[model samples]
Target chain A: MPSIKQIARNEAASSRFVSGHSLCRGCGIPVVVRTVLNSIEAPVVVINATGCLEVATTRYPHTTWQVPWLHIAFENAAAAASGVETAYKALVKRGRLPDEPIVFVVFGGDGGTYDIGLQALSGALERGHRFLYVCYDNEAYMNTGIQRSSATPFAANTTTSPAGKQSFGKLQKRKDLTAIVVAHHIPYAAQASISHWQDLSDKVVAATRLASPSFINVLSTCPLGWGLEPNQTVRFARLATETRYWPLYEVIEGHYRITEQPLDPSLPIRAWLEDQVRFKHLFQHEDAEVLARIQREVDRDWNNLKRRSEADAQWFARHSERLAKEWTGSAARPAPAMTSRTNTNP
Target chain B: MPLKAPKIAPSARMRLLTGAEAAAHAMRQINPDVVSVYPITPQTPIIQTFAKFVADGETDTEIINVESEHSAMSAAVGAAQAGARTMTATASQGLALMIEIVYIAASMRLPIVMAVGNRALSGPINIHCDHADSMLARDSGMVQILTENAQEAYDLMVMAPRLAEHPEVMLPVLVSQDGFTITHSAEPVSLLPDEEVRRFVGDYRIPYPLLAGEVVTQGPFAMPDYYFEIKAQQVRAMRAAAQVFDELSEAYQACSGRRYQAVEGYRLDDADRALILMGSSAGTAKEVVDELRAKGEKVGLAQVRLFRPFPAAALREMLTGVGAVAVLDRALSFGGTAPLFAEVAAGLFGQTVSLSSQVYGLGGRELFPEQIAAVFHDLESTEGLEQPRFIGLRG
Candidate 1:
């Protein structure tokens, strides 16, 4: 129920992820985490994957997390969150727990979500756990020295996929994880960028308020790993979204909705690629083919999303009976606790 | 539906059930808040039957059918930390997948109880009876107890939560039975009233829970400064498990007229030779001991019930009057002696008795009474025990 401005102002007074941890000076992960956490209207239990957020926030006795938090291993954040949600249901149904609902949320990195943890995440969603999973896609294994994950871009340089004389960095294009998540047929799944705080915040609130598994993928910036000046983190994120490289969008039920359109006379894809050191080699080598390929992939993805979002307003209305009949298990469970209406944003 | 008569007289009642069924029955009695499990060979019956219990309104336990054992244990850790009385079951590769989080559950001091059906590890992938699975987690800091029969499986499982939830010992407990050998076979087990069972395991009170409005950080990134201290907390809890188990078992015995000890001694008094083993194989060893005693061979047997927190002093005391001892293990250590053999050697490092080791029952190979008697005879015949022997193995 909180507006974006009100949530930000309230968080400014008392931060859930406190300062003084050793994350990079302008890292976008904290911004994404804080923004997502502020949108929830209930007491939250945060489960974090093993990444910059987990390692830097909690170092032995000192922890920056003011909320109740847990970090167990790298890939089981979703699996662990399923436990919390299931436990909550079992206790509440048995009258051992209070009636108040506590939101279950997970913070996983791109490496954890797109690679090692895909099975667990898929399983939790398929089982219809009532929780929210946010993948802070910094695009590589930044915590373990920037290895190339499936989330890493095709031509981006990483420790594992370094650009050399004979070869370009990361030959394969990044996986369309949002599409893969939508294939699970959960109620809500979205693609947002940390630079678009309002879009990401709205997606988090919508995802957590539902009683089915929900996922949001945010393009979080990593200064140390992405080779950017500490101050240029937000600029890089903004450029990525403006160039249509990372679109601000959401998928509620089966329909896609774009939250922000690119600005008039938007910046070129080169502007998005030129600032970060991960892509500096592309400029130095003047690899026209790689740049064109990257642009082509982005445009194809954006056009696909635009077509889906521009569908008639009655898309769900036409398919509502089938969606209900298709899933009779937890997918179709009655959610009395989620009092708010479903996100039918056009 | 018309029923003619009650199966049992009012004075006493018993029913035939497999090891898995006994475990499921115990779960119903305990009525855990959450149960997360995956289906694997020799362990499928347990979760399947428990799911039926939930469907039939026998218990209000929430049964989560997870994708794999890794998630099964992972979910249990999260639920236990969230202050729910959680339980789970797995075996072999399933158990192997769960070892990482098993250690985490113990470290966090979450008193979750797991029932493991002992099956062999892979390579050839045989799904039968063996102790290889349970031995994989011997040092994971969880309290592991071996059961000798379906009756023992039920009794031990019912008592596990008490030991696990004790204030002094808040580590996880694993109640293991040999796969197929105990899990598939049926035996008569006495039933306890659900009301009595409920009173036995009262409310669970966690010191700090995730959703309890109190700010608590779990599974913290421990640096060098406090890693050892946090680990020592688990160690202290593990060490306190033996006493806690003993007290609870005595209390349970007062309610039901069955007694269980950390290490059960069978005919060990004034014996010249003996055999020591764990799990269902001990039943064969005890039978072999009785047959040897009938022949006046002066033989005895020792069954290890509590393997972790080892009960080293009690185990050593059980073998006091015996001469040569044969330590039996169903799993191999490859480069070293088997786990039980190693623990036994460490327990009696300076003792004067001649010690022998045997590795048997790998991949569910049949163990017989004769093989156990042979071990006792071999211990008596040999001048001094040296090389490790393989029981019932082809030459």
Candidate 2:
């Protein structure tokens, strides 16, 4: 077997994308996309939702992607990808696409995945398309000038949900998308952050190997949208996971497993809050109680995950053989390839 | 000696089918790769029949059940842009909801064909024949075709994809049939043979900008510098559609033994006054025209078929010797004049024809043949009328 370093070097040299495109400097989304595409060896079709990913890469006549990329509307990337995957399966069944196995993937921002595109995503998952969905969670609607989205953090000031004399930024809690995907009882669902590149790459590769729908919610940092220095994208993302403001974990076959644990039990939330203008209002107001309340919520959520991970690990070990048998039986059959000849004229 | 009337071919069978079923049958014949649809009243049967066809294994098309009309059009646009022929159906409030992306579909030139079961606009709640929904989308860069009955509804739909996908006319087509009048009514309509339609329409050829290995841009934001040029190109494309329409109609006539035109005339050859109308009301006017002609009254009717391209030159030539014209529209333009009436007056701008515009039959109220004939009476009584008039309204 080839060493990991050799594989990484080979992928870097043979990348389909070239340097110097219009994407913002240190934008975390392109990094995540490049890493995921580099890991897949099969022929892949990417369906992109209407958001930052689409606007930056496809500026009208110019496109940055060398692969077969489709830019559908804002809310139906999942549905469109479902159609593509269905067509591919029908074609393959008729002995088309015989050259190799093909993979289907969808990419979207939080506004697209957690809010507008949620219905299509839920339907696609329920229909069980053998594909992976990656949500590049940049917190707010970054491409539209940093507006508040359902994924915006609590007490963070955004354009739509500004903190003023009577307001403390966004009062609503961020939606738990990972848990929502797990409720569908899919085969694999994971949450990762840009801070851990190696772990993010490994999870992407593993998710694609599954026979059912798999979801990965990636915490991509937006230097411009988050109001930080352009080069501090990775640093901000690391602080997010380190402070337990965000968590990294996976749910496999109705079981939850925490991939990382916070090292400090009583870390001050102010450290994570002080980096950008979105949280500057809290510091200006000197509202310690509000800050303390948010910290408690984060801590409580993290502890619950730790407990569930332990229970899930125990259950999986106890019934490993039986679960394996059930999985083998329930996994979807390999879809046949689609070809022009199979599309008969009605 | 009169020219021999075209013989009706015996092999061409006619079946009584609703407008919705006719549209569904036409779509089945087109054999689109994907169809994304949502269920709304008046437009639901189109999808229900399509769903049945897919389930019965009668057609091999992928049907996506979307949550809303907005997503349905979005999905169809995406599929069409991805090199697949795609279609959807909606009406009334559903069409109103999809107003935003409908414009986008046309600007992108995706060659999408939609059937709008024309219904009354809201406020007091009505769901019958009216042109409110489709008239609202007049300037959205779509080729708008209005049908008179179930037969025209079916025939227009089969011709829609061909008109929309023409290389010079790469624009979306909106085939509008009166909501309950035609959509729910069953009538005998001759179905076109599938091979004849395929041969007439041919395959969709997207311009070089969108094809594989071609570096071209589509639907980009036209800044002040480029916006004018892009819009100018769209205007030119709309004008080019007239030629495509004529060519296809000629070809369809040769193959199927029936002919259609942008404007249909009824007994207008020797008439001093003509009532202009659109949609199913033309059927009622046709009856009135025949009755009045038998009574030796110098009255006739002219039905406007294509609304978007307006067919200005055709209407001008058709109305050359006419003394006075009365325009009847089923939709209200609020403070302004009626939509079809306004288009007619504008089409005959430089011509020397006296015109009277009237707004009536709004909210799907009953439009009697006598009510339409009253417009002719109003034109005759008031010589050189100064402004447009409204019929069937309380004092």
Candidate 3:
């Protein structure tokens, strides 16, 4: 993991993502994008879904990206990455391109990852494409305005799920997207936050090293949508992990490891929710029942993660070598056969 | 280790192949860097045959059997932008689903080739021969080529990538074959030598390819100030495709001994009445033209090989001296004039020719010789043809 000083060095040495763009002041997306891009050692080709980062960064005749970047639509970033990765394989195999280490990265928002793009992402993962899919989970569709996405938390007010006499806010709990990615049995999947820069950086590096698909769901802050002061972006992101509302952990080859153990595991989930204006109605109405329900859900989720990590640690200790062998062996075995016809016409 | 080219040259051979299989053979010869596809009826066999080629180690192409046609086209776009030769295939609903990205592929200037097994769009959920699928993507900015038979399907599939990858015309190409009629029906197809085809396509290299050492941004968002200009560049490319298609078809004819043109006229010289259409129905119409000509009716047929650029000039030139013209359309445009008829009307707006529109073969409704002959007979009177006539319908 790179320290803040080292991250600054990396940024200076290779300014892959530049600073001038139209993203809201102090938006957490740039932090996530810059950190993720700077963390990788190899050349990267980024596939972005149409969202705040893509639309804002690369408006025609202007671009903040210094590295190769592609944006197709609001959804299908993973599918696009799958294509780039496959093309690299096909080209290198045929000697049309030099065989060099190139990392394929996908940047998608919560709406693109957890909602419309789910099928494309799932298909790419199942096909076992070597790429890293990073979802900047801002909890709502910030680009199209504060629409309630599947990643939006329970009772969090959004434009689509606005609080009213008939409704409190969004009715459903946020989907456990990291767990869903892990369920695909990919080589690596993790839950990260922009606040924990080192953890997110380490996960990006690790995810890119895998020979198969990997996913990282990073909790990104939206100062405008979440109704926070420009400077409070990192503070709220840290609150998310500290309150155990969004735990920091990773699953590697089915082995779970808790990357960050919150200093105060018993911290109230309200610590994360109370600061955001989206959740202000819950406090104003003195909705004790809703607040308690949120707490219970967080507690249950945190406990489940901790239990899985502990169980996985014991099993992995004995089977680490075998698991590593089986994973890498399956990836390397049966290399696709290459055949070509005679060039009589040439 | 460098791959050594085999000394033995592959020879051209005539083979009885389904249109889908013919497309597969064309793909096999092209041996593109990547092919992404999903299984849709009529279009399925094309990829299925290609999959066997990959499995049998005949080609080293990276085959991605995507979950949906949307992903298939999406992956193809990505691969193309990443500087690989890419292709895909789909049918009606599949084409409908994939059309969004197809538009993007054109706008982004990725030379991805897609094979569309033309089928009717659903409501009654019919899966049969019709132009509804490709017609849905009529304005998508991709080049649309309609094939008359399995032979044309093979020949055009071989030519599509080269046309798409043309430096001046880097747009996606949709080479369509009528569903069931050509895709499933077997016919004698003359395949060019594999090496000849490999040389014809050459290597696909593009400027500012992704992962090409230098970083480049593609598919960027365009604001109002710059969006129209960017679209104008695409318009120029489509215009360039018309001439490029002719140049390529002539080049292909030189080697394959099979000539192709944007619009092919069958005995239109000094004819009084002409029928114009596209796709497999041209075969049926040609036979009707022959039957009518023997009886001294002076009838002719104009088949459109390229539909996207509309081939208006060649079509109008062929129908210039003809007195009466009937435009047959396989797909309906509902409340509007049929798509082909609209184009024909627009093309011949000031021409001194009497025009009529005929709609037929919806959801693979049979288009027989008699029906085509009736369309010719209807052209004689040229009355009550203002409202698009539906042929072979029991009124």
* Top candidate (lDDT): 3
lDDT of 3 by residue, A178-265 (tens): 8889889997898999898878877776677668999999999999899899999999999998899988888887778788778787
The model with the greatest TM-score is 3
TM-score of chain B of each: 0.96, 0.93, 0.96
lDDT per residue (tens digit) for residues A1-346 in model 1:
4566777776987678888888878888888888888877577889998888899989978989888998778878988988888888988898878877687889999999999899899999999998889999999999889999999999889999998897788989899999999999998898888787767776776676666899999999988878998888888888888899998877767787777787733466888998789999999969999899888888888888778877824675565566445433222123221222332221
Interface RMSD of each: 0.8, 3.8, 0.6
Each prediction's RMSD over C-alphas, in Å, is: 5.0, 6.6, 8.3
Measured as a fraction from 0 to 1, the native contacts recovered by model 3 come to 0.80
Q: Model 1, range B18-128, lDDT digits (tens) per residue?
A: 999999999999999999999999998888888999999999998888888999999998899888999999999999999999988888898999998999999699998
Backbone clashes in model 1: 0
User: Which candidate, 2 or 3, would have the higher DockQ against the true structure?
Assistant: 3
In order of appearance, the predictions have TM-scores of: 0.94, 0.89, 0.95
Model 2 agreement with the true structure over A146-230: per-residue lDDT tens digits? 8999999888899999989999999998999989999988978989887776556656665776667889999999888788887
What C-alpha lDDT, on a 0 to 100 scale, does residue B144 get in candidate 2?
91
Sliding window of 10 residues with minimal summed lDDT for model 1 chain A: A331-340
Off by over 4 Å in 1: A312-346, B1-11
After aligning candidate 2 to the native by TM-score, how far in Å is the CA of A179 from where it should be?
A: 2.9
Q: Which DockQ values do the candidates obtain, in the order shown? A: 0.70, 0.22, 0.68
Q: Positional deviation of B324 in candidate 3, in angstroms?
A: 1.1
Arrange candidates, best DockQ first: 1, 3, 2
Which ranges in model 3 have alpha carbons more than 4 Å from their true place?
A319-346, B1-12
